[model samples]
Target: MGAQGCREDGRPETVLEGWFVLLLDLEAFAPRERVDAFHHAMTDSSVPNEIVHEECDAGMSARIEGWRVGALDLFDMRCSGLEVRRTARHVRQHRDRPVVSVSLQTQGIHRAEQAGTRSTLGPEDICVFHELAPRTYGWSGHGASQAVTVDMEHLGLPVDTVVRASGRLRASPVHDLLLGHLRSLFRDPGRLEADPGAGALANATTDLVRALLTSAAHDERDGRVREAMGSSLVPRIMAYARRHLTDPDLGPERIAAEHAVSKRQLYVVLGRAGIRLEQWLIGERLEAACRLLVSPHHAALPVSAVAARCGFSSPSHFTRRFRAAYGTTPSEWRRHRIRSIC
Candidate 1:
């Protein structure tokens, strides 16, 4: 519960961690409905996976705590022993984009493998892996792990660079720097969700990852790293967009001006990430609204206020979009989770 309370001056009133999204908890599902519930919760709430639990009848439990740092998806997950995999078939069937993960084992034993490389990552040890390539997350006993996921294309490193670094333990000082921020950030992701400086914190988080990976896998002889970093435009746009998500003027034109680019350039950059600008904006706003609906800090606010807080100019429009995205109106969704929120 390190995630709430702020001064009227809009500064942290206590050492409380920032608020976060509670993705899922197995205990919330009925025992008879747990399997499909977990599967859907994991696949739809986070990444898609083919899971093999140790015992179906056993009370397998998990809680997925997560937040977004711009384009990166940060997750802190604890669970009973299980084997999880993402393979070519799963990727093809879902049309999964090429996403990658940088993770640390927070508890118990964890083994991971991808692209013919394998590593046994322990607490404070870091490892990297990706979708569209075979990867496995397994443990013989209950454990937890925290990860930051970003698309391979958005990483600003050559695919070969990430491919080579996959399943390898990073022991350098750079690894230490990466893990330090990750641990600190995960401890209070709520800050990034509610603080006015959320955008800065999120960008700093992404920058640390980019630096660690670039230094770890970069080959100075090819001059590709510089080229890649210069050409990576999506992160910049996302940083601007995430910061101003609640701004009524937030849109392609304003964002483009903020980044010193044309509206066309903005679209081109987002297009490279394979998501239209408007679609991405709506999706992010809906996600923000959904988070506020269930979060304690914002729970006292009216649903209309939450929509405005997330930048929707019209409460009715926000309601329609929220229902479409989550299959329930904002009020119903909030009421549905009253027990958990309280």
Candidate 2:
């Protein structure tokens, strides 16, 4: 939420957490038609699975809404008595992006089976499972859950650490914190996603999940977890800075303030990662300007406009730096790129 307000470049506000794109209301479908439609939606949704429930009763219904938040996908799901299976076959058939699924049970009973372990979760209970592994999950009656799927690599933990933590999340001190966050997120998904700082919020959520896993696995002795935890700040800072690159005032003081660090501390973190803060910022700004110069949509804009959009306040200064970096002026670079494409 510390991110800058509205952009001045006139681009539409960036929606960090994308709008929910998958919406299904199966209650209106005929009893016989509901299962197939639900099955199709299940297969097509962000997480692919095989719908195995055999009954097609009149009361059966399912509604799922999914939102994308950076490296995470969140689903608000409600259904009446159904099972979904994700076998090794399903794993192979779908895209091979390994992820971990965290589910917060809010209504009815949710049953999950994975790695020879079966768990029955009631309201306010949480469960975690690896998406690439063979698993079966569903409920026997009407149930609702808020599920978040995050790319495994983003956790910065080894596979064994995650596997160990998955079945024992409550052992972690931060489990309730993560649970409460998911609850609040799903309460008004659209409104929250629309917030300007939703991207940073999502990143914070991912960090909390990582911390929870590290604590649950009792991985303080494990150097991988310890090192990952220690070294995460650099990436976090870089991401924050990149998001604000369009702001001319995105300097050390502003960045340090947003991250709750002193300007000196910010420099120390990036310095440890071999980054020269001023040069890095300039490089990123130049790179952004280069992309805009060659982009078809921005081609009509003058070189000065392109420089201004990328945070440069002086057109002549932008040209000099652009030429120094790319061996040509911005206008020349854009013309060359257009000619090459044609």
Task: Pick the TM-score winner.
Answer: 2
Instruction: Compose the digit string of candidate 2's lDDT tens values, residues 99-189.
Output: 7788888888888887777888877677877766778888876778888887877766666677677778787655665676667667667
**TM-score for predicted model 2 compared with the true structure:** 0.59
Best by lDDT: 2
TM-scores for every candidate against the unseen true structure: 0.57, 0.59
Full-model lDDT, candidate 1: 0.70
Clashes of 2: 0
Q: List candidate 1 stretches off by more than 4 Å.
A: 1-18, 56-58, 94-97, 169-172, 219-342
Model 2 misses residue 297 by how many Å?
47
Worst 10 residues of 2 by lDDT: 1-10
